[model samples]
Target: MGLSSRPRCQLAEQYGPVFTVHLGGQKTVVLTGYQAVREALVGTGQRLADRPPIPIFQLIQGGRGIFFSSGPRWRAARQHAVRTLHGLGVGRAPVADKVLQELRCLVGQLDQFGGRPFPLALLGWAPANITFTLLFGRRFDYQDPLFRSLLGLIDDVMVLLGTPGLQLFNLYPRLGALLRLHRPVLRKIEEVRAILRALLEARPAPAPGGGPVHSYADALRQHGQGGDPDGLFSEENVVACVLDMVMAGTETTAATLQWAVLLMGRHPGVQDRVQEELDRVLGPGRPPRPEDQQALPYTNAVLHEVHRSITLLPHAPRCTAGSTRLGGYLLPEGTPVLPLLSSVLLDKTQWETPGQFNPGHFLDADGRFVQREAFLPFSAGRRVCPGARLAQTELFLLFAGLLQSFRLQPPPGLGPAGLRTVPAPAFTMRPPAQVLCAVPRPRGR
Candidate 1:
């Protein structure tokens, strides 16, 4: 289970910084505490960079994408993913425009609830569609059946990724495959791939005049057609990479937004402070922009705190590229290393209040928003999340836009206490099912 690692870190404090934990009969080295995690993942990143093979992910299109593959294959796929996104304006005004556009539609949809309780289940849809637009040159309507199904499948896949069956499959790949325990997961993967294939097929050939590289699929196709002797970016790899973009990008960002809403509702005082900052920084009728992040210090702090409070993935699995020493221990080549990121997020020495939801962790004495080195919600090192900037932008725009436009509150009859947040175990730590009321704020308040 991907629960808090503080207890394990406490054990580490007693035993040692680096200790071995038994997982599915495999001895995995666990690095706890900020100094240990940072030293191994950041200091000797490349040495500890290779991804440990998981049977489930290895079955993900034969492990062709950036997230699963290692060595030259991973390098080429990652380079393509990064370069393609950068070419598509991932960290710039173009991507922000896409996010803002979707956010506007999302706000409008929430307005129809009329301050009534609404499930934030499909909160990931807009961002998923934003990613869809980036990958396939199209966006799905909020109520599109296909779009909803895709999101549902993605959510199910995340749930499956953390199951005991998956763990057993990871440990004994052949036996799990023989038992067909991975069949359900494989079916879902096929469904996701089918969607990607449809979108790829829908793409028209590049114009004879060759104006501009349109979408991610097109960019990938153009690259593949350029005749690579290495065959790094093959057609199958293109689909897998698209799947990676959608899978890697969607739930994490969506879960962050969901946590933001829940936290805002749970702590109305903090929410108000953020709204106050939003109003003071950018007044009525204007949606908050990425540039506004600097001016809106309290809001920025709250966003950072939300990520800190709800550290998503408890740990990231890393493998030693070669024999190397980490945390004062000699790890042999191909040794599996689990960097306890949750420990770092809630490290006692680094954070003033490691257990509480305090935005002050990222706030300076003068109320300026300051970045904390311990904020490793995205994890770090050579294999750090490739979509960090895009995720941050989505988080900022969605968080700021919603707070600016509405006063988020718990469902009627459910106070903060009634709205208890239990962690839903998945590929990430998902928030419990709760309803939030987006009470539209009066204009010019």
Candidate 2:
């Protein structure tokens, strides 16, 4: 996963971009390359928007929440989430301020290491705290027990979801149920649910005036009180939504940052270039802003390359909402579709150098940042990620702010090549458990 290539490249070349692959008893259509995957997602629109029942998630959410739910329920949950996020200033200056605050917290934590090696997992703390702030209207201290516990549970669930036993259970639910393969995951899930339930219980009722939701919890509360006949905002659904939001909102940006840091540490030349750009644009004393991305083209390209290279949520399988023609093939209703995003990001025809860590892919000869058509890190269509803007803002400030403050590199004894880049097998393509040193940069320019 840490490598710049995907095996699906060969598969697509041999079998064409669109082909059917069997995951145990399930037959899922795999869409590879930019054109094929985009057709299934952007071209087909909502026809491929629904999520098919994956056994583990079905057991966990019961077709509730934004990520896995379908039909009217999913639509309503997603719409409300988008509105709530905007109301809370997710994509605006307010969000940049909040993210910058969290970034300072992260930088402080990293500084405490005093040039000693620290686990890369520490990078995730900032993004997770941002999500927590949105969900609970507050953030947790780095030493808080609840914060550590929630992160531990999330880590456990992510690793468990990618385990072979769970994969088998997802493929053959009834048989795996008899063999008891799902108990571990369910146990971890219950632990997380208990924490969230307590949090929801502790929330004071939404204040009068039906004002815009300040937090995700308040948003769900308002949704339920709107006399929701469909019961979309029931207690259980709210819990599911919160969990989904936390899991989805936190993991992607966190994982991508991990990748960015590692990539920077691995390629010192590239890191030097990015630092130079940061120094030139914002100088040593000023903090990085989201708006700085326009002026700092090299740093911006580096971040975009991070997203393009990792392709975190590669196979976020979608279910055919109805019978439709995709990539010249007819798919029946409910056909599970694997829109292989990794394949698209690394498409030979799309990227100039598909297997190298080059930021020039996002740059033109004029040395300005250029958007590529294949940079669909957030996916597309009706089921597209609602938190895209928030994620970008978080990434921009955190990445820029960190490099602006500290020089990221591997441990003293461990050189760049000594650091392992292969992602630990997890639901998300997160950097493997590794260590890096954040040496404080000089105060004077």
- On TM-score, the leading prediction is 2
Clashes of each: 0, 0
TM-score of each: 0.96, 0.97
Alpha-carbon error at 18 in model 1, in Å? Answer: 0.8
Mind giving the per-residue lDDT tens digits that candidate 1 earns over 1-445? 3224766777787888799877665678888888999898789958887888777887775768788778888888887778888988888999899999999889888889987888977567777878888888888899888888899899999989878777778887788889888998889989988887987898897554335786888887887777678777788888888898888788888888898889899999998798888887788888888888889989889989988888888887888889999867888999888888888888889999989999999988999989988888888878888888888999999888888888888887788767767788677888987778889897522
RMSD of each: 1.9, 2.1
Model 2 regions more than 4 Å off: 1-7
What CA RMSD would candidate 1 show? 1.9
Model 2: which ten-residue window has the lowest total lDDT? 1-10
Question: What's the distance in Å from true for residue 137, model 2?
Answer: 0.2
